[model samples]
Target chain A: MEKIPVLKIGNLLLISIQTDIYDSQGLQLQDDIANLLQRHSFRGVILDISSLSIVDSFMGKIINNIASISLVMGAETVVSGMQPAVAITLVELGLEMPNVKTTLSLEKAIQFFNEKFNRETDQDGSSQE
Target chain B: MEVLKSKTLKISEEKDLLNIRGLIREYAGEIGLPEIYKVKLLTATSEIARNVLKYAVSGRMTIRILSDIYKGIEVICEDNGKGIADVDSAMKKGFSTSGSLGLGLPGAKSLVHVFHIDSKLSVGTRVRLIVWRK
Candidate 1:
């Protein structure tokens, strides 16, 4: 009933998926997030899924889709703050997250991205040397 | 002595999923799983049931209370639809032919204590998942 919230912090967009992240809702939400990523051309995205108690096939697919699309858009996606129980469930389900990054907290994720950004900038600056 | 089973259309319909969720919840309550655990079970069941309805045409799901001592629930979802050609690959996360996020089987497997799946090409698929409260 409650719509999933999407927030933008700097170049990164945070999509707070509030539901169980299973079945049709999960698919729909993934599509919405993908559209947002393509439309806005964000540099990074964090799927804050701490609210989801369980991760099902549909939800997993959405996460995978987002990660895959982010790469195409030149944006990196990170999934942060997944419940341990949910994580365990996902492993047992045999869901493999290939290119997506994962973090324990959003702050840490942002920091990780910031570091990458700085590193890339430093490399470019030194190229002239 | 609690059991529930349902026959439904292909895996895309949402109504069949709702019915399956209700049934799983009732059984979870009867088995006295903690509220948090019950919610997890409900979500897991819904995901798998939806897959059965969507991927396999005319599937049936059965949930039964295993025994009093163990306080466990076992669910079997069987469908004679197009079978999964690669069971191992299908079990992998983010591996979906349908362009979905591909978390359904993996997610359901994560929620319960024991999860097993079997599929034969053109023969359909069957999944058995078990959760214990004790």
Candidate 2:
């Protein structure tokens, strides 16, 4: 069996999940990713789901949970590279993850994060009550 | 009345993980399930199939389509393997006895209209799921 891979880039954590996203192994990967975010204090997480062929309601729930928990830990979560079919399946299953950002590509996701980070820093530098 | 039934799938070495999804789609379609319902059922069935192959060593699934005012598909997946010792806790979202993401049962339940599990420690585990067309 192939293992799901996780990588850290700057303050962003990228998790390359192997196996169908509906399976137990894939869900475990979600939990593991959440733990990593809490432990490392990453600023953001990018879940690269291009490899997944399927995403069921259960997997969606786990991903949603991860995104929510990450926010509590002060980390924003972004899901990128979702196959169109997987997105359709998730929508049909009524699986919606609130406050989770999505991007078409990793580069776009990184750019979005950079912009958000810069804006935050600028605001912090200028104290306006 | 016997509303719907399919030929028994032979348990064999030729069967791979992908085959399970195909079987599920065929049966689900036969039961008049919408395309969306078919996709969800396929995913849930695939998860259970993976469990069968990983833990049971070998097994087969029987799907029956129920007919009434409300049409639905019922899948009974049975395997002789190490039965789940703590089904209640296992049903929790993040609990996995195999250290897996533990989403198999929870995912399956979320996809179907009804979900039930029956198991004996040494005997086996039988998972039943019904997905109604909406």
Candidate 3:
């Protein structure tokens, strides 16, 4: 019954997962993301997982699902602020969150998003002129 | 068995799997266990716990911290499910009946200092994992 809040910043959607999410909660999050895509004009999503201390394959798959769903909807997804422990465990398990872009921190992810957004906007602005 | 604290959790549904990882992290943090070892224990517990739920509808996990020469965590997950027919094949990566990433058993074993598994046909499966402070 836990609800994760998704914040809207400009053309970007931000989701910060703060706790260990259950199966139902993860699925609910995916639903929420899908709904948001329908309601807004989002160009990118940054999932902040700085507070999550555990990253099992099951959890990794959920994050990957979110990223893929977003990608299919024409939006870029980046997971930011992964702990060293989580990163090492993911590698050692012979598993990775497939198809999702990962960044070291939220700041870097936003910067990356901005650069991509700017290039596309600048090209669009000039192409019409 | 110089046990400092011991606890058991029931794993019956997918929702319950989260508890397994949370409990391991809590216990590891309480002991001030190193970050690497804590992640190891948490990851191992996650793999085994998921296997229990995937293979069996219900299972139990017993976790204990021992005060031996060095502090260590002992996790034993037991389930009365269909049981693994081929232990060796099951242990091999990419060999799964449920089509998991197929690294549960092998990955869990690699993360712990000690690993043991016993499965009987038409009976159940029991897996034990131990991680000591480094």
Strongest candidate by lDDT: 3
Instruction: Judge candidate 1 against the unseen true structure and give its global Cα lDDT, from 0 to 1.
Output: 0.74
Deviating ranges (above 4 Å) for candidate 3: B14-19
Query: Would you list the rank order by TM-score, best first?
Result: 3, 1, 2
lDDT (0 to 1) per candidate: 0.74, 0.74, 0.86
Model 1 regions more than 4 Å off: A1-3, A121-129, B1-12, B15-47, B57-64, B76-128
Give TM per candidate.
0.69, 0.58, 0.91
Worst 10 residues of 1 chain A by lDDT: A18-27
Which lDDT tens digits does candidate 2 get at residues B44-63? 77667767776777777877
**DockQ values for all predictions?**
0.26, 0.16, 0.56
RMSD of each: 5.1, 6.3, 2.1
Q: Residue-wise lDDT of candidate 1 within B46-69, one digit each (tens)? A: 667777766775687777777745
lDDT of 2 by residue, A13-56 (tens): 88866545334566667777778876887999888777766775
Report the Cα lDDT for residue A44, model 3: 92
Q: Model 2's CAPRI class?
A: incorrect
Model 3 reaches what TM-score against the true structure? 0.91
